[model samples]
Target: MAFFIRWLKAASFLETKTLILDASSYIGGHLFARLGTERAVATYYRNPVGNVVYFDALSMSLSEVVKKTQDITHAVILIGDTKPDSCASDIRKSHALNVESIISIIKFLKERHIKPVFTSTESVFDGIKGSYVETDEVNPILLYGRQKLEIERYLQDYTVDFTILRLSKVYGVSPGDGTIFTSWLEQIQRNETILCSYDQVYSPIYVEDVVDGIIKAIDTGAGGIFHLSGNKPYKRIEMLEMLLSIASEFILQPVNVVRCSINDFGLLEKRPLNVSMVNDKIVKAMGLVPSDARELCSGMIKKFYTNGAMEYR
Candidate 1:
């Protein structure tokens, strides 16, 4: 009975009280759902979904929010204007949230004895080269990437116990998930032309894989930076072609696939062409083997058909 009691105590210690900021966001929502309300606390900005508390970084500080909520051993920050065009258009506002507010939260958490898990993007790389490792030179071309890079630099200099997960493009398996694959599938179903850039290359990871990696990082008490991305690098057009090939088996309508340069997509800022990362650090640290984009696409396509596509049609 005493040995069993000791084992229960150890298990309870492993289950830390995690605070998921911006829990309404895509990644945040998935983490909250996986962790559940019993093991995690969620915060929302506008839409309060699945038992979340209000937390507007523009108005309130992390200290204020922490005071109102339960004690948290770790905080997963998912706040900021993630859109590149938006950040480029309004530099001041986006900078305030992405850099300043994020730093403030990290400082507050560190001061209050809370481990912070920040979700950064793979855009920190300049994309001149593919398959970037953790210790590679970071030169961000887009404004959004610069902002994320700034935080990463700060974490390297300031904190020792921080977990910075630099993620690639994340996609989900559900319908209307607003991921690239799902969006393309919808357009294909409608018989619309899909214009994908041939120059742009990136690693696309499954959302569940990302969630599992984050949990593993937290549970295992991982520190420093880790790249959470897909196993292989693929050009934008290559990924689209893969999707089209798989989609041919299910869809009746024939959709046009157009290949264009990355520059053809007129944006306020220029994007990196190849931001694929080498996820060896994450694999070594967390023992994570991520799913490839093709596998995820096949699963999503099968799920879409099995759930009755005629209703969607």
Candidate 2:
């Protein structure tokens, strides 16, 4: 009874740490839903939290974000999924078109208000010759890459207490979302053959690990651009094969998996042959280790199969 009482007290203490999430996108929504189990929180621009204020980025101006920040202990800005479409074309024009929405929040916060933390991506790197570090020069080749790079530059010039997380390929089991794993899962479930890319290689990070790393960054009040990715790199088809093997365990149906070249898809933009990131900085700074891709895909498959596709939305 004494131990139980002490444990309850410690849990209660953890519930009071307020962190405000801006933009209720993929990672933002996932973080808020997960954090609700253990932390106190608020939101601006979006209601990642059920009971918190929903600051609509479209309707609410930046001053509102500043006002809300004053009341929270920490602020996290998730920059993806803001636009309706995730395609490269929409992403490239997002910053210029959403300038009013972006400036409002910046102006609001600049008035001696709460500090903001921004999330960016490694897509900013062109993936030309080698892996990139935090201090490396950014030369993005794609539209999505360019937009993220612009946002990073804007945020760095706008605020002092900001941290930029340059993420790599993030994979998880979110309902209806077309992650690399899910795309293959969909085809496999339908008893269809999946032609995966053998040439493309990337460092895939599990979404949960990204969240944990972000939480650690928040705790330490660490600022600056940090790489959040898996420890090792895997070819695109190798990852698909791993996912197919895991799915075969619970799923009785056999999936036809085939290797194909990137040219087959005729992707709009030229993708980097190797965009594997080295997350030594974040690991060293936060003493964190990301989970392997195999484990992540297995868990994702299990969740999808158990919950069914309708639960994704």
Candidate 3:
């Protein structure tokens, strides 16, 4: 009986050691907090946060970081260029980090038998269709999406024991989190005219839900592609209206709303119209039911106002 208990402890310890690459990223920060510093070690290029070591995908070696951290079972790769416009403008620079460096890291981890959890984007699918599933054909419109798909394809063809989480637009509750929701709130608070796309559609999942899904994926040893998204698809105009309605309850101010096409933003590439992914795969794998987007927005506003912590910029 004592021998069995000892063996279980050893197994648990071996399985739980995870290394979070790009721990300074928004998702990485939330994940680090959830997993705690002891259970997970982190790597950052510029900002060295809690329990993180320096690792530049361009200049440094991934093996050195791996050598420093022993008995690591999983390495969540979050280091890459995620900006659509930036990727479109400078393909070579972005590809070097997004594709080349990432592939190299995957190879290193694979050689050592460490499972990799890669955070992909819903942008992999073209916007012509909504409610994308794992089996659907992907036609990424944005350069960022294509870059992500490149890695996804590499993983599918070359590696096993990898978790590809194709996430939707992830938003946080904080005011300056830089997500569309909070950024709009900041603009509205400052009485700036908000131009929202009437045709754009997506599943905007909460950061908490994304973090939960990633942690669940790692813990359960679930491999394959999964979509971590909101409960339902929402139009850009509808989402803005929902936020406006919720914000009106907390702040008494006249807000300006301008309806426009996504092209009006002057982005280097055209945005997808309906990149809303279905989270059924993750649901079946981890039983992760995402929080309602409207409810989450309402709760976030309520928390900020009720706590009296919101400062108008």
Candidate 4:
């Protein structure tokens, strides 16, 4: 019995030792930022007991990424979702710049023989319908959605092993600009009125839940497309109201909230009226249960304000 117990302990040790992460993209940057300095460690394969190594893609080349890929038993690619283009020519032109960045990374990882775990957006589905499943056909109207769909096809065609996580709208505070949460936090902090779309519906995943889902997927070796999203669907206006209510409860001043039609925004592409995704596959496969949006938002607000992230906005 003692020998059996020792063997089990050794196996447990080995399991923890084999995982390594190659976080070279923006999503990687944000994920590690949340995981923080304490959990950071060296190569998982070499150390046999370490956590994750945060590799910055900007500083490293494709060769370096390949070297790390060969060294680790498991790796993850964290890329950000593409942003929407506005009707204005200048805005559309500026947003178009991201397409090259997205394509380049995909090409780089492919060349390195590193099968990446791709992160996509629910915007890929035209908001005309809701309750999209894994088998549903994707029809993206927004430029960002189209780009992601293109990449998804590219990866599916070329890569031998890959898992696509089509994420719902994400909410959380980060250090720099970008993210709807950051924008909303800034607007609320300044007591500025924020315009939200009433017609558009989306399910929001808390940043922590996103990270957890990713880790779960990685650990389980589950491949193919999965939707990492919130279980509940809420309209843009409803989300704003919930945010305001949470802020007020936390002693933060309420900001004026305005509802606007999607057409008035002069968006370049049509947005799907519904962007909610079903989470049963991820939940059943990965055993991941996402937190309620309200609770998640409340936690994020507290973390931002108490941790001085609010000051940055």
Model 4 TM-score? 0.73
Ranking under lDDT, best-scoring first? 3, 1, 2, 4
Candidate 3: the clashing residue pairs are: none
Superior by lDDT: candidate 3 or candidate 4 = 3
The lDDT of each candidate is 0.85, 0.67, 0.85, 0.64
Worst 10-residue stretch by lDDT in candidate 2? 1-10
lDDT by residue for model 2 over 1-313, one digit each (tens)? Answer: 3223323534665433434554256676667766773464556443343666666665665454344323443456664443223445565356543444455555554553434566667677777655677888788776667666766777788666667788888887665566788777777767798888898777888888888888888677677889988888888988887876777767786667677776567776777667778899999998878997776677777777888855532
> Per-residue alpha-carbon lDDT of model 1 for 44-146, expressed as tens digits?
9987897888998888887666763345777898999999999999999999999998999888877766778999999999999889999999999999999
Once superposed on the true structure, which residue ranges of model 2 sit more than 4 Å away at CA? Answer: 1-23, 37-49, 65-70, 80-93, 97-100, 174-177, 248-254, 299-313
Write the candidate numbers in order of decreasing TM-score. 3, 1, 2, 4
Off by over 4 Å in 3: 1-15, 309-313
Deviation from native of the Cα of residue 1 in model 3, angstroms = 28
